[model samples]
Structures are given as C-alpha cells and as structure tokens.
Target: MIRAEIVKLYKTVHTWIGVSCGLALFIAFYAGALTMFQEPIARWASPPAVGVEAVSLEDAPRLLELVAAAYPEAREEGITLHLRGHENEPARVTWVEDEPHEAGQPHGHVHWWATLKPDGSLMAKQEEPSDLAEFINDVHMRIGIPNPWGSYFMGVVSLLYGVTLIAGVIVLLPSLAKDFLELRIGKNLKRMWLDAHNVVGITALPFHLVIAVTATAWGFGVPLWSAQESVIFGGKQKIAMAHDLERWRAPPPTGEAGAMMPPSQLLQRLNAQVPDFEPKVMVFRNFGDKAAAAKFAGAERGYVGDTRFGGVILSAVTGTLIKDNRASRQDLDRRVGTVILALHTGEYGGITIIWAYFFLGFSGAWLFYSGNLLWIETRRKKARKEGEVEQSRSTRLLGSATVGICLGCVAGLSLTIVAAKWLHGRVADLDAWHAYIYYAVFLGSITWAFAWGAARSAVHLTWLCAAFTVAIPLTTLLAWAFPMLGMWAHGSAATVGVDIVAFIGALCFAWVATATAWRVKNGPADSVWSIRKAEGRTAARQSVAIAAE
Candidate 1:
C-alpha cells in the first residue's frame, strides 16, 4: 500500500512530462529514423547528371597538376578526390571557396567541382545539389527550428525527457512483469492505449535513454565545453585544445619541388601499412609541394566509432605514412565520446545496424504518439465520471494540438520527400521549394486540426499522410512509366530500396487511417477523440454507458 502511493505520485509526474514533450519526441524520432537512410534518400532526390569516374591511380598525378595550374588557391585550401561517383557528384575533385562577409564571420560559400577533360585539361563548374537529406537531418536535430535556439530548446526537452523516462519506469516497476507485453483491446480504450504505450516505452527504454543523453550532450556541447575550459582546464585550456586539434591536422607542405605519388600507389601503401584501413575519401593538402600530405578518412570495419575519422595520413609525394588515426587509434577520451556519438547516430555496425536503428526510431515515435492518445482518453474518463456530455475545453484543445503536431510531422516529411522528385528542375530555386513544400503542408495540417477539431481532422490527416507517403513510390513508378518527364531511375539498389520502403510505409499509414476512422466514428461518444456527438443529456449518459461496456 505504501509503495502504491509512491507509484501514483510518479505516475502524475510521468503523465505531465510525457504530455508536454511527447510531440517533440515524435518529430525527432520519426525524422531521425528516416535520416538513417539519408544517403538513399539523397540518391532518390538527385537528378541525372554527368557522372565523373573515379580518377585512375596512375592518372591522378596529371589531374592534380591540372587543378594546381588552374586554381592556385586550391593548393593551400586542399582538394577532395571522389572515391565513388554518383548522380549527385559530377566532379572528380571538389573544393569550397569561402565568401567573405561584413561581420567577419563565416557566411555562405561557393562549391566548385572539377573533372579531367578528354584532352587532359580540367573541366570545372559551380554545382548545387538538392539538400533533402540535410533538411531532414536538420529537422531531426532541431525539430524544424533554426540554430542555437533550437539546440537549446531541444536540450531542455531532452533533460525533461530523461526525467520522464525515470518516472515512467518507476511507475511501471510494480506491474511490469504482469503487463510487459499486454495489449488489452476492449471498450476500455484508456487501458488498451496504456498497454500499448507501456510496451513500446519499456521495450525501447535503452534506446530512448541513449538518445536522450546523447541529444542533451550534443545540444549543450558548446556551453559545456566552454565551462570546462574555464573551470577545469583554466590556464591550460588553450594548450590542451591546440593539442587535441593537432592530432587531426595534416602536415603542411614544404615549398621544395617534388613529384607526387600516384593515388593508386598511395592507396596501396596505406593498405599495406595499416592493413585494416579502408580509405573512402582522400584529401590532399598543399598539392604539388614537396611536403604535401594526404588524409584518408574511412572506417575500420567491425568496430564501433570506426567511421568517425579513422584513417591514416601519408605523404602525397613519397607515399610514406605520416600519421595513424585509424579506428583503433583513438585515446580513451575520444574513443568513449566517439562511441557514444556512433551509438546515438547509428554510424557503425553496417547495414544490419542501420535497419535496426530505423525500426527502433519508428517505435520510439509510436511510443510518444500513443502517449498523447492515452492523455486524451484519461481526460475523457474524468469527464465521463462527472456526467459531462463533452470533454473539457482543455482536453479538446490538447487533443487537437496532439493530432495536429504529430500528423503534421508525418505528412509534412512525406510530402517534402515527394517534392524532392517533382520540384527538382521545375522550380527556379529548388532548395527553397523544399522548405516551402514542408512548411505549407505542416502549417496547413495544424490549422486544419484546430479548425475542425481532433476527431474529424484525425481521419482527414491520416488519409492525407497515406496519400503523401504513397506518392513517394508512385512518383518513382511514374517517372519510369513516362520517360518524357525527364526523370529516370539511377538503377542503384539504394534508390530502389527507398521506393520499396515508402510503399510499405504507405500501407502502414493507410491501416492507421482506417483504424482511427473506425474508432472516431464508433468508439466512446463522450470522448474528445470520438466524432459522434450526444443528442441530449439522457442520450449522452446512455452513450457513455454503451462506451464503458
């Protein structure tokens, strides 16, 4: 009996925290799950362009010479050699040119791409690719808010989210074993929802905790770093920071003339030296100079944190190893930090881990979504006990907001992803159109939810989400069916997989829409989530009795 009171107290705390932060978590987790396949989504959005073949190891020397002769500044700023060519990447070499701003801060910069011509001359152009993947990533990181403020806001949400997790677990401890997998489906709608919510929340508790902690750390990293520098590091802060940065820096070039080794030779040398190193992108600093160095950044397979800048640096001229920073090369501090980041981002363990994270992310989204539904149902129970014909104004308002924000995120992300294909060449500024498409649909959903109330809007928005998600696959099929539209499949498995997953997602949304419509029309009439209104006081009590039965 004494333990029951403690559980009840925490339950109230859990409910408040979950209701307050559930919407944000829904947005973050849903978008974050999609972000697991960012590369595939990027390929799906990219239009056909002239593909630049990977520069041959032997021919890399000539390409380097041409770039050096054409852009002298590139010798200092560094140039990246593409290892794998795709529709989005049209150049063998790429670099950024900084654009100066009045405020003396880093502003917009131009991206330059270059390839070797048939006659051995360099062909270069300024390029802009669709930023669909990046936009989704931003939404996941900040829940569609802009910079520093967004980060701070998410940090606060994450902290609260952690507190809620603890409270929820404590409340569930007394009955966890008895109801861990229970999903009681009956006229008692609140009980059923609570069961589903508990299942997801508990099953994926570890994943949520990791995300909560890591998200807080990332969102507040700048402030935390500053505080540590000021308080802990103190006089040695600058020296320590410089030392940390130096480990990742490439050696500067010597001015003396020297012949650069072919890229193939460098690759072979790197493979021979590290044996476990797999080079993905090679960066050459101060090309053509005697002391020119190359940094090969790639993963050491089968290791956590392997993808985070784990490779060796070598002399571009002599093909000799200069610095080893492979996956296993990190010190204790960096290794732990990188592993935490990797776990949060799902950056390691290959394709299998990616799919696992993908599903877990969606599950997290569902947990918060069901949580909101439970809140509405709980309020409805209270109103019913009081013999009220309708749920309270606050309950109705929360229901509307919950449906609006959650479904808005779902439908908005789907439509924006669909826009990736439709708006590519049709718009003068495709990048801006991405934002326009998302916000228009998002705000439209929210406005609709508030205007029409939760019951009616829930059905409408679910159908809309189904339609938009279905459009993703239909767009691909239509592109193939009508070649005259100037869109064609890239014939890669990645793009094909995107269309397949989207089709499955559409089916899921359609099922949810059907289920929600049935519940709204036929479920408890006194509930804010129900569409059927009571004719009179007697009818309302009868309706409540019928629902309770």
Candidate 2:
C-alpha cells in the first residue's frame, strides 16, 4: 500500500502540473481530434475543380507529355499524378512551382493543376488549394502561437504533463481497486467531477501516455536533433538523415531524352511487384529522360505508418522497381519510428481506430478541463470561511480563464471551419482569412469571459460554440441549395461525414449551454459558477430573522 504522506505529496505534484498545463492540453487535444479527419475536412473545404477523372489513367501519358513540353521547369521539380481521385485533388496531374523571389529569402510556391481541354490541348491554372485543414493542424501543433516558441512551450508542457500522469497514478494507487471505475453522480458535485475525471484518466491511460511521449518528442524535435548531433551522433546526425532520405529521393536526369512509359503501365508494374501497396499519388521526376524515376507515395496494407512517408520508386523508362521503402522493407529503426508516429496519429486500423482516437481525444480534453475545475473547487472549499459571501479572486480568475480558453477554442475552430466554403472565392487569400477569423473570435471570447465574469461568459460562449458549429453543416446545406453562391457541396461520403459530425457536435454544445445556463441561475451563489449575488442577501436575511425570533 502507498504511504499516506507519499500519496499527499504526489497529489500536490499532480495538481500543480495539471493546472499549469491543462489549458494548453485542452486546445491541443481538441484540435488534434479534428485533425484525425484532416483529409475529409480538406476535401470538404476544397472547391469544385477539374477532377482526377477528367483524364483517364490510360490518357495520363499524353497529359504528362503536354505539361512537360509546355512547362520544362515541371520536369525538374517533379509532377504529381493523382491516383485516388479524392475531391481535394484538383486534377489527374498537378505540380507546384516556386514563386519568384530573391535568393535566400522566404518565399511561397504556386500550386498548378493540369488537365486535357476539350480540344485535347493542355489546360493548366495556378489556383491555391484550401489550407483550412492545415491551419487546424497548425493550431493542434502550436496552439495558435507561432512556431519555435510555441514548440518550446508545448515541449515543456508535455514534459510536465508526463510527470503529472506519473504523480496521478501514484496518488491513485492506494485506492486503485476500490475507486477504479466508480463514478459517483450525486449531490456532491466535486465528488462526482473528481470520480469522472479519475475514471476517464485511468481508462485512457495508455493512449494519454503515448500522446504525452510523442508530443514531447515532436515538440522538441529540432532541439533533440541538435542534441543528438552534438552528443550521440558526434555531428554525423545530418549525414545519417541525408543517407536515410536517399531511399525516397529520385535519380538525376540524363541529358539525352528518351521515350516515357505510360502511367497505367507503370501502375500495373507496381501492382505486380508490391501487391499490398496502395498508391495515392505517383511523383515523377525527369519525365522524358532515360534516367527518369517515379516515386509512389501511399500506404502499404496492414502497416502502421503515414501514406506520405513510405512507398516504392520505379524506373519510368522500363517500369522496374528502383527503390522499395515500403513498411516491410524499412530498416528496424525507421520501422520503429513509423510505428510510434502511427500510434500517435491513429493511422493504423483505418476508420474504426480514427473514430476511437477521436472520442479518446475529446475525453482527454475533458479530463484536463475537469481537472482544472476540481482544482478550483478544492481551493474554494479551503479558502472559504463559514459565512464567506464570495469566492477568492484567484479561483474566480482561473474559472473565467478555463471557460474562456476552452470554449473560445471550440467556437473559434467551428467558425473558421464554416469560413472555408463561405470565404473561398470571395477572399483574395482564403487561407490567411481562416487564421484571421479564428484569432479574432478566440481573442474576443477570452476578453468577453474576463469582462462578464465566468458564469455569464460560460453560458454565452457555449451558445456561441453551438451556433458556430451548427453553421458548418448549414453552410454546406446553403451551398447545395444555391449554386449561384459560387459554393459547392460534395456528395462524397467523406465530405458529407464532416457535416454530420459537426452537426452532432453543435447539438452537444447546445445541450451544454442549456445546462450551464441553468447552473448559473440556480446553483450556489457563493461559487464562481453562479451569476446571482444572493449569498450576502441570504446571510443578512438570516441575521434579521434570528434577531426577531
């Protein structure tokens, strides 16, 4: 059995660490949950375009040749042949070219998609794809703070989070059997909340542990690499990384031009060789040269890794497998790394695992949110004297912050998602507008929370969350009903699923708002969550009644 003092010490450790890191973790987990369906979200946000089906696999050769002949730079930069026909793929063939800028300065790339026009001539346009999903991912990684600093902050938070997890487990060890799954839902609100938090924390312990470790590693990846170079690799880390990258790199082009193999034949060759490999896209370099190579980026069946990271490369001229870096062929170190990444990302086991991780992510976020509430409740009980009419300023401030940051993140993300279709063609840079809308709403909600106090702002922001989230589906509905709006509603299952999930989320938020409103009006007036200032009035009335008696 654990010692009482030891348990108390660990409890203190857990509380402080959790309180310090809970808000950031809530944002990370919430945004990270959305990213599980990043592809579907990307497809949902993408506008109608010349689809992958516009040019058949059989006709891909002609399209490639036309693009190569028209834009010689594409040959050197590599061209992508879309295979999955996802809604996000602008066309059967697409490539990106670096925008003109002075050397050694920060620059952007211009996205280009090529298709065969009605007259069989090359048709290409420079149109940027919707980056709403990527922005959400960025928020997940950086929590809306710019990189380097954000990464360093999250790294420290994740490290402390891991310590909190350990402290929590130690604190719970003595009562492990007795309180394992017991969730007491009764008049004792703090007891109920603590029970629920413990239950969820213990149940999803493994998942949380994986997340903590992976997040820390990734958050400090740059620093870790530098440390490894100095300490472990003796300055050979870059050389090692470069060598590892060689498996994915394409061969240099020969000056002499040669006949190119058709994309269909190359795929057939791919299938015969790597039967389990599903290619999403084939990236071609040196298209017309004798030494041309095509790198396939996709998933290998039953593998636990990202599609973008591993695949085979083929000689475009002879349809021969040039390099195989599929999961099965990966070196032990790479395979282990891939599995860890897949575990963190929920990339394995397909859709079922994705949904599992989705719910788990929300549960994790709630665990942190409730943890903060428990801390506030604990402090309130300790600081309050018998007839104290008000909560401590610290508790009140923390309460407002908790509600503001969490609900603000929710409302901001929902509204920004709704903006994807609404502002697509209307804005010169829809991507930049996404960031603008999210930050504006997020910061505004925080300010509102501080100004109005926690009780009122919680209800208000919860309602805002519901409204914004519901708008996601409503926006899609409007697009479907009115084509003149220059918006589109895709009929694909993936895109439709995004709308369905958002609608359900909106309903959940609405229910929470209603419950929160009821609590604010009717719950204990002495608490920060109660908007009514009835505590002082009640105490004075009791004294008057006692004197008369």
Backbone clashes, each candidate: 0, 0
Per-residue lDDT over 1-71 for candidate 2, one digit per residue giving the tens place of the 0 to 100 score: 78899999999999989988999999999999999999999999999998999999998999999999999
Best by lDDT: 2
List ranges where model 2 is wrong by over 4 Å: 534-549
Winner by TM-score: 2
Model 1 per-residue lDDT tens digits across residues 337-427 = 8888888999887899899999999999999989988998888888878876777888889899988988999899999999888877788
Each candidate: what lDDT?
Answer: 0.85, 0.92
Per-candidate TM equals: 0.94, 0.97
Stretches of candidate 1 exceeding 4 Å from the true structure: 54-58, 100-103, 534-549
